[model samples]
Target chain A: MRTSIIGIYEDEKVLMDAFNRLQSEGITIADVLSPIPLHGVWEKLKLTTRLPLATFLYGAFGAIATFGFLYWTSVVSYPLKFGGKPLNTLSFIIIMFVLTINIGTLFTFITYFIREKMYPGKKVELAVPRTTDDQFTIVIERPHNMSAEEQKKINTLLKETGAVDIIESNN
Target chain B: MYNTRVRGILIKGNKSFSDVSRDIIKPMDDKTPLWWYISAFIASALLIWGVWGFYNTITVGIGTWGLNNNVAWGWAIINFVWWIGIGHAGTAFSIFLLIVRQKWRTSINRAAEAMTIFAVMAAGLFPLIHMGRIWDGFFIFPYWNTRGPLWDNFNSPLFWDVVAISTYFMASFVFWYIGMIPDFATIRERTASAVKKKIYGVLSFGWIGNAKGWLRFETAAILLGGMAAPLVVSVHSIVSMDFAVSVVPGWHTTIFPPYFVVGAIFSGFGMVLTLMIVMRKLYRFKDYVTDGHLDAIARILTFMSLIMGTAYLTELFMAWYSGSEYELFTFMKNRVTGEYKFAYWTMLICNGMIPQLFWFKAIRKNITIVFIISIFINIGMWFERYVIVVTSLSRDFLPSSWATYEPTITEIAVYSGTMGLFILGVLMFFRFVPTIAISEVKGVLKETSTLKSFTDEN
Candidate 1:
């Protein structure tokens, strides 16, 4: 069984303070769950994301693909004269621009879901209840071999840093 | 660390995170209110009446409408444009305010976006039903087929409208749904009933508000917002092109794109004001949808109303300056002094004149007066479309082709139905969904709260 140590915080500022103190004490945090997104939490946790870059690439692909499709259908496949205007034209730009947004947003949303392992009907095992409401929780993996004295010390530190409660769970 | 010098408190009451959740989610937990049932009943009645109209339209064909050869496009087109303009408010409110980093948008954006979705859905019905043969609507799509594999006219502005509206609808829905996920997760955790929890769980897509998820979520929001910003402008511009591309005297103009976009945002803000005021009053959400928020919207409408006025005058000037007889007749004679002058003046008063009342601080502060003005703006915008469509088509280049237009009972019924549909959708949203975005309101609470120091220390 794996053990986890959780510190429940009512306030975000206190949570941030406790997070920094835990880092200074050379403790590794497994994750922080928050009701609302805590400012600067990602940077504090040394997390980086490439979702923006992915969205840009998706958008570029959509633009190119849309333009090519419009050109092929209008100019190459079934070219027809309308009021003597050119068959291959810039009128497709608006459609291409719209489709780029549509494709980019749809793909990025899917990527987010896949990366996060999220889908409809997926069971949610919350780290701590009400973390989605008003609470912030700091989770740390408790080493199996850690002495009782060390565990008590960690609990005391959390209390000093204004954690409203400390919970240890094994699953 | 809000500078009080610049703006009022966004979330009026000093609310803790738990308090924010409790306040926002309270409505969903409580018994259905009497007003909701009353409103829903009225909306359903209107919807049923509208269905009868639609049934007549589909059965009797396009001949059932007030449409003649001269004024082929009447109330259906007018209502479509009006509803679309109303639809612009949600994305415009959320995305533009988001890009500008307006913290106040947090309290109101969710409801506004919901309004957008419903309004767009309502607007979309017009073009489809207006086709006279709704089943043949697929002919507008550019797809492969055995019949010469004939593609839709890619060069047509009408085709662009199809692409634009669908893209706008899909993008707005995605953006709105993405914003709602974290909030849904909150509701999932808060609700007592097992069924509610399970339903919200699926709706939330099992969101767990981890640090990484929040980061990605915020980043995606910005990305989507960036992309959708241009969409908010493009959708209505394309809608405007449906008219502007035609060589009809008042229809053909280079000013249509920007003018339509501005008009869209103008009317959209008006609708948002109306809806938000109602929501604020009915839900007792004064702390979240504070007077300050309404003030900010009124100011925006004031500015937009000025631009609308300028666009109107510029149209007149262009018609006269270009020395085109047809343009002059459309602007000076047909619309201004001719049969549609009532609609023209009504549009001017409601859209161009009434919103200017916001310049007075007292007027903007009064919620009732503001609400009435919003309704007037809605009416005025409808008339604006009517004047543009009817006047331009009714008396064009040739007198023989000219004919006056009046909406049949069926046409009016279909419009009433859309109104019913719009109201019904909003009512359902209120009853089921969290009217205010719980997570987003909490996210801004620290910065905008009056008791910031208290929250920080707690």
Candidate 2:
């Protein structure tokens, strides 16, 4: 069995301080949850994301595909003379640009949901219910075989670093 | 971050994170207000009237409208452009302010975005109903149909309008919904009702608010905002191209794109001002949407009004300088002094001149005065479109085509119905959602002067 320890704080700064102190003491933080995004918390967690790159890639593909469709339809498939305007022209750029945004936005939206393992009606079990309101929660998981002394030291550290409450559970 | 000393405190009254959430969610949690019922009843009545107009339009056909042979595009197109211009407000408010890092937008953006979605919905109805055969609307799309040579003219500005408006509507919806997820999650955690909790939970998409989620959320917001900024510009520009691409004397001008864009922003800000003023008063959002925020929007309008004035003058100058008799007749004769002179002058005073009152600090701070002026700006912008659409088309090159246009009862009903729909959408939004973005307000709470010491310690 693994034990999960949750430290709850009221202020984001105190949470950040507790987070930094735990890391310095060689404790691994499973996650930090808050109502609003904490400044520098993602960086502190050393998490890297390529969502921007994904958006760009999606946008490029959309632009190319949109342009190709426009060209094939207007130039190759069914070319009609539009008041002496060329069969293929820059008018396609507007449609291409708009479609690219639609694709990039929609694809990135789906990507974010998939990456986060989130969906409508997904049952969420918050470690601290108030984590979505005014509270900040820091979750740490450790083996149940860890000594009581080590657990007490971690609890004391959290309490001293401004954690209002600490709860331990085993799964 | 820049010094907070330079800007007014975004959220007033030294708000805490819990306070922000409680204050915002209180409206949602409390019993429905009576004023809402009254307003909603009025809006529904208007909507019913509008539905009658639409029924007549669909059943009776385009003949019910006031459109003549020469003035084929009357109130339908004019109202379409006007509503589309108004739709620009929410994105303009949220995306532009987000890019520029204006913290003041947090309180007002939710309402503005809701307004945008509703306004766009209303705007879209005109073009569909104006088609006379609403079922044939799918023909606007570029699909592989059996009609061998008719694949939705990829070169027509009208087709561009369809694609651009649809994409814009979808993009704005995505951006608005994405921004609301965290707020919805907050509502889910706070609501006492089990059913409400379940609904908000589903709406929130099980958002956990972990660092990784915020990381991706912020990245996605910026990406969407950057793309949407240009999309908003293109949407209106394409709508303007629907006119400028034509050879009509008043319509055919190289200046239409920029002129239309500036006019759109000006009118959008005008409508935002009107909605926010009423909202702030009704919802008692004085603490969140402070006077400074309204003043900022007014300042933007004042500046845009100047550009509008300049654009109007530029059009006049171009007409005289181009040495085209038709252009001169359209500008100086038909618009400036002819039968449509009332509309022309209404546009001039409402759009080009009325907003100049905001240059005074006293007037900008006065809520009643500001609200009235905002209404005038909206009316003025409508007249601006009217002058562009009706005045030009009513008196083309041939004197035989010179015939005045007036909207029939059906056209008037459809227009008012859209207003009713817009109001009802906003009222429901207020009743259900947190009018002020709770999380965003909480996020900015630390930046206020009262909390300056708190941030300094961090």
lDDT of each: 0.89, 0.88
Which digits, one per residue and each the tens of the lDDT, describe model 1 over residues B298-395?
Answer: 99999999999999999999999999999999999988898889999999999999999999988988999999999999999989999999999998
lDDT of 2 by residue, B66-131 (tens): 999889999999999999999999999999988888777888888888888999999999989999
Where model 1 places Cα greater than 4 Å from the true spot, the runs are: B1-6, B450-458
Interface RMSD of each: 2.4, 1.9
lDDT of 2: 0.88
lDDT of 2 by residue, A77-118 (tens): 888888899988988888899999989988988898898898
Give the alpha carbon lDDT tens digit for every residue of A72-169 in model 1: 88888888777677888878888898899989988988898898889997888785868998899998889889889878878988999999999987
Worst 10 residues of 2 chain B by lDDT: B449-458
Question: Where does candidate 2 clash, by residue pair?
Answer: none
Candidate 2, after superposition: displacement of residue B113 in Å? 0.9
